[model samples]
Target: MARRGQRQSGATRPAPQRRRPARDADGLLPVLARAVREVESAVERSDVRPSVRTKFQVVALLVREERSRVNADHTSSDAYRAEQLRRLDGIATILAKSAARETTLLGLLAEDAVISEAAASLKREMLIAAGQEPPREEPVSRPTTPADTTVRRVVPQTVVQRQLANPFLAPDFSSAPARPPRPGRLAGWELITPLLRSFEHAAASASKALPEPTTLRTAEGLELMPHQARLIASAAAGHRTFLLADEPGLGKTAQALLAARAVGAYPLLVVVPNVVKTNWAREAGLWTPKRNATVIHGDGETVDGFADIVIVNYEVLDRHVGWLGDLGFRGMVVDEAHFIKNKKSQRSRNVLQLSERIRTRAGRPLLMALTGTPLINDIEDFTAIWEFLGWIDETGPRAELMESLEETDLTPADPGFSAAARARVIDMGIVRRRKVDVAADIPARRIADLPVELDGAIGRSIRDAERELADRLVARYETALATRTSGSTVDGIDHDLVRRVAGWERSDRDSAKTGENVFSLVRRIGRAKAGLAADYAAQLAHSVGKVVFFARHIEVLDAAEELFTERGIRFSSIRGDQSRTTRQKNIDAFVNDPDVSIAVCSLLTAGVGLNLQVASNVVLAELSWTNAEQTQAIDRVHRIGQAEPVTAWRIIAAQTIDTKIADLIDAKAGLAATALDGSDDEVAASADFQLEALVALLTNALSE
Candidate 1:
């Protein structure tokens, strides 16, 4: 039964048949073979123009399409099929080499990269030249939104009065940036994608080259830490924009307010989270007393029309975005800038629009996007942050960045372009300093996870809720897969679609309200873990003298306080709703009063402004959505004046969503570590982590 090409023996068979290179006489193979060679030569010569990149992508796409066609052709003989695949592999090898030579071309090979019309048109021509009609191409539809996507927008009467009072303060286009008369060297090479990927492979120190510290410039007896002073000096030296991403508890608020003062960015506008809105005014007075500060509350009825610094929270920003944009504020600061990572969200749009207005109005405003979490989820997080700082825009690098790349004297086709590009971007005022970088100025801190298994009925409910959420996610995923019209079926789990479905569940108000969501599930987990966290806190209180317990929900706080009372332990309660005096009084009691062993604090309120270095031991009853939040809570005790090394006891529920979120946060922490600390760990995935808990864990354990 042996075939003509093979002969069988008792112990041995004829040598396996060799796969000869198939002739490219009659198919798309000839066109792709020629195209790949062209691409290779173009890249080798450092002439990888946009058209050349398009050809490379087309050749790669056609090779894959033809290989699939050859393997699935029932009429073709097996020998012919094998030879065809071998030839296709040869073409693929050339494409790989070209990508290696011009690394920026590698982005076009990614699965998520959209196929441009040029590439599609090129593919059609190649297939037509092979005497076959090409199929019609359908455009990929992304989630779209309206221009004014926010639910509502309003201008307060006081804002209108302020604007009327300053009628001469019309927008000053004289200072707006003019477009370059001619295109730069690397004009149309899709530099944004390459620039973003630059960070993923980054190893250089994250911060910009800062000037040495100047003398402390505060009006009061307040003094700046050395690292803080260096950044202020950079601003004083006329650096306009900064992605000031020092780790939490590094006093970013002080730096920002003082930076505005250094530049005399009067009529400064600061957009921050609601929890820290009041603290901005307080810190402004403390750091730069010469500058008057006012916080805009509901409708901004009491907002000082002529204050030197105007502060507004993100929640009410929608109402004020109108007038804020109209006002000619010389400087703008977005605190917790990560909140605007999702560019489609109303808040993100508002922030971007205001930044644009500021750029247009002021010649060169002092724009600072302050966030300790350099990346909350993924490398793409840099897009919005960069746009807010006027580095890059929707299409590609704006004028300033384009000019920097031009000075590199290397195209995307040239060797070492990515690194050079990253360095240029860093030079554009990415001031990242970790606490470890200033460890001499501050004590060392560590976060340790304590896995606690939930065994009782409460645990059962949490597990059940978690299962329900997972099932819903899976069902949605399957439905999406089945209904997908685009014939692009992936081999395994489509993590992109899973992320999309999870985002829909989280953002779609109707669906999120109807079913059990991640928020409810997390709250349930926190409620269930209250007693266990309290017990651990009680133990720590006895051992370490004073322990700070942080919880997100009031019910969890009440339960912890009840447990402490049953054990007859004295504790102080601090909450978001508490008045300033009351909150401070409780904090004073916990700090000065030795008998108060634990301070039951709200993670949202007490996490930011309070100085609880009196306690070295801290217990977390609930997990936060972002690493920065968790770090903020722990940093309440990890700041200056800590006598010993700090430890954060993260009470993670084993085999639950709690553990997944913990790992995700840990992965995101690598962004700051690598970008800021210049450590070995690479940056993690996008912040849109929801259903890929298992995927995250595996990626964390394995190399990319």
Candidate 2:
């Protein structure tokens, strides 16, 4: 064999070939593959705090680099380029899967996601892991000359005075200890969802038992209810934080003002909805006569810096947030606290940030989030409320709550954790009481939906518009099916597909100017029913001492006011366009003036904060999109001071989307019941009335 081994060696030596190590058959770069694996592993582990943010940044950076390389490579054939792109897409798919595991991570994938310093650092670490040199950090250039900008807000003199009075305001940490770190059993696991789940499963029993009142202290002539007195007792016993979710008519206003009085939480800050700013001051006077309460108007020209109680509305909170933070308030009460449920809104941000500053400055400060209808859509609506109460922070439970969760010896994954978590949170100051529970303390309230038939051309036009809209939606759904690659046949109609089509139609309605949308159609129905609703309200005002007529549109209000004027019925107008003084004057005319038989109010402006309990009967001229709005309107008359049973008449247009919307509002009310009132009813996941109305219309059209 020609010296067997020697011959073979000579043949190989001809080229002096070098053997390369095995690589992925897919041809993924070694560095990129390593980075992908590392990131995937970190994101897959729930206990590792899931490096979701880092993973998103690394994958995003890789995608950008890979796209650039693919674009610049002209040597490669289109097929080869497509294959590279597909491979990169596979990496992106993994990153998406990782994000799907943590709901909070989804926001990072948004098109406008900002690359923070931490994200940039993580990108470099990922690049280094991929055996590639990270890009050099570019030096941030300083401007040669500072740009001049006008100052938007000047520090108020009251703020300066307050600061001068308490120059050494320091954060009190005595209530929250830093030592002996207490990591809970659920410390590593996300517990917010489970904590909320507990509320969902809570029984619809009456209010939970409260501590016995040690001493019943009533404000001069103000007689406290048994439940109200009990809360005052708890405050006197040193309970600092409370989420007073008692139903609307249970005297939350009185309770909040008096509770502050009991704890000596003077120089208290009460943040309320604009509609209730005046009401808060009035209630403060009634409940705590000794404490001087001042309401802050625009620019706060009339605000008393040294008043015992300072009341400000949410609308002007932004302008006042800076000074309010430096005002050294010992207690804070946020009325209609559900306004801050959207944690991302500027209003919510200002409220939560100001609350945080107050908590930091006065560790033992009394914080209360008072909302009769707290659970608007979801149980997690409690997030901002809990934050306002200082029981939890942005990261997770605060030290005291963490300690409580730790003592439970269970994680969210455990079976018994939910109840334990609920008990723990409830013990930390969640007070939920329904009108049914305290029925004796307050009058019963009923919502009566009055369906009216629309006749003639306008009515027919409305019906035709609704049918046309539904037909359009159905056409879209069919088109989507025809284009689907899979020839899959669905039974009846694919509800999910139907919902998707409805959602598209609904969104299109917002921007589309040529077509009649659900919103416009509802408005049309309101217009058609305006005369009838006004006639009924005029009749009600005569039968029932006073009637509060509420409507969503100014046109409807104008029509009702015109009818009232023609009928010789004295009426007062409360609309958003009116100045605060005008609004107050109109409100007073209805409340204190016997000649003012009706208060024609904007459902949005006069709904939440005004105490129209003076009128036991309310006429809702048009339906609202949400049950909360409707409840707020009805509650304006069904509050604590009302001596008679309250009835709300909701005018619904028959044989139209208005009836369906009225039903949807009633259905949506179940969300609050299941969440706050502890009803076991199954809550519809989506409380979006407009979407539901579109779905109903499409379903009906498709069926026909």
Candidate lDDT (C-alpha), each: 0.76, 0.73
**Candidate 2 ranges with C-alpha deviation above 4 Å:** 1-151, 169-181, 205-208, 215-219, 374-377, 443-704
Clashing pairs in 2: 204-678
Q: Whose lDDT is greatest here? A: 1
TM-score of 1: 0.47
- Model 2 quality (TM-score): 0.47
- How many clashing residue pairs, candidate 1? 5
- Residue-wise C-alpha lDDT for candidate 1, range 42-80, written one tens digit per residue: 876767666787788788888888877887798989999
Clashes per candidate, residues 3 or more apart or on different chains: 5, 1
What's model 2's lDDT at 695? 91
Which pairs of residues collide in candidate 1? 377-686, 377-687, 378-685, 378-686, 378-687
